[model samples]
Target: MQHTNILIISDIEGSSLCRDYESTTFLGRGWPRACLGMSKDVNAVVRALYNAGAREVTVQDFHRTGFNIFPEIIDKRARVVQGYRQGPVPGIGRAHGATGLVMTGMHAPSGADAILAHTLTSRIARLEVNGRLMTEAELFCASLAPFGLVPLFISGCPTACDYAANAIDGLTSFPLHQEIRGSEARAMTWREQMAAAAAAALKSPAGRPFNPKGPFEAKVTLRKGSGEAQKLAARWNLEAHGPQVTIQARDLNRIYLELVRLVYLNRFTQHVLPPGLFLYRIMGRLGLAWIRRQLKNLPPSLR
Candidate 1:
């Protein structure tokens, strides 16, 4: 494990204190608090990685808008990548010699009865590759394969942990309970427990890169009555049946980028995406600053 470097991909739905759809998006009633909790949860793991002798740790904010975690609260030792990026790997660039990846705040794929379950976007009912339901953890792990990075660990809801464990051999998963039925004092222990478990899992990590069989077929089923499928199919020149659109590719990375384009971009937007992403990054920073201001204005008891 000498000179080990770890990459952490963080999402909102599986953050320690995030509980519902509302908490997963900006300006939702619980969004600010959720962001704070996510920061502390990630900070604990950052400390643990460093203590475990990791030479470098990089965190990618993989959730919506990619601006969820509060940088001020995260461990300064780790490099944090905010917002989205475009490349062969999509939001995840090349592994850049990182030894392994650690995904935090992950959730189950769409159609699962897990906390805030969805893949890529809630607009899509589900995403399937080679007839099997897809999860972000699986996609992220597969994206890093060309760079020789394996999945070291994951922490999230039970369903999410199970999906990742089943998909990648020898991957260590820590599941935070879906519900904590007790006093707030009792409920607050999950973060500490998660930190300890994650640290323990990384003490001696073992796993191979996830390389799913390709010549892939992907089915994107948009939610019923959403009227999005038709628009997307028309935009991409793909055929749509009812609410489902199908995509085929020769490899996982190609399929992954296709899914990204399906969910986030169209022909016109693709042309202006660079500028759009820049503006979005600015908006994300402003949104986070606003959240910080709101938190500061709250009474100390609530804070």
Candidate 2:
């Protein structure tokens, strides 16, 4: 059975070109190239999904500014969703009619040994749910559960893939090793293998949506002093323990939104969210234009 609409959530930390913090940051010189690598990775999977009988594909740029993917480079058949949205999920808006989801260019959660490892924010020392270290893949899956979308495929660093697979049983994943960067030939081979595997996962579409039963407990450990944690705890009315703050909620979706608030918002920002988002959208357009110019000057292989 062909999934009518499939969503591919793309990040940057696990993309082939991302080597460190500089590669993942929007202002860094390597960021444009990193975006190109990510766009290519997403396009490969998008093409594979189309060939595997998917009727429609949606690619959501889920990196820092949500403007990393070069829309001009990805498969035209896929609708690209960019920038942040104020919602339960925060970034990607509604699930629409998507029956399944794929995660690519994802990295390991906070406290992991993967390159550019961090949860929602670098300030987060660690994030735990039900005593287990939680991953963004798990959180994304749970947030989309109400839409009845199952996690179909994931491609990322070894640690990320392993954690995602463990979180969602029977989910398929491709681990793009660090050694692949040693040569262009190896990178191409890795992309081919990942695309084929992603297609197969979409065709089979195994497992159910990750809707773990709750009352859920989220423990967020900050990297620095307890002051920040105490402030956030007081603001959210959560429990602050040392440098950590704990949130309890009956729904995973709620927990996700709260986590977003913790990572990206404050009292002043929260009140001015609409204007802030508008400003961000304008900035994103300018940044994207700059990236276009950079891409044009680069060689075909890099683009």
Please list the C-alpha lDDT of all candidates, in the order they appear: 0.79, 0.83
Model 1 Cα lDDT, one tens digit per residue, 1-303: 433688889987887667687777787877777787778789888988788778789999888788988887888899998998876577765668687889888899986876678888888788888877788888888888888777878988789899889878868888878564112343358777777766666654457778877799888999863378888888888778878888888877677777888888878898998899899889888888877987787655443
- RMSD to true structure for each model, in Å: 2.2, 1.7
* Candidate 1 regions with alpha-carbon error over 4 angstroms: 1-3, 181-188, 203-205, 224-227, 299-303
TM-scores of all models?
0.92, 0.94
Candidate 2 error regions (>4 Å): 182-184, 297-303
Q: Give the local distance difference test score of model 1.
A: 0.79
How much is the lDDT of residue 160 in candidate 2? 88
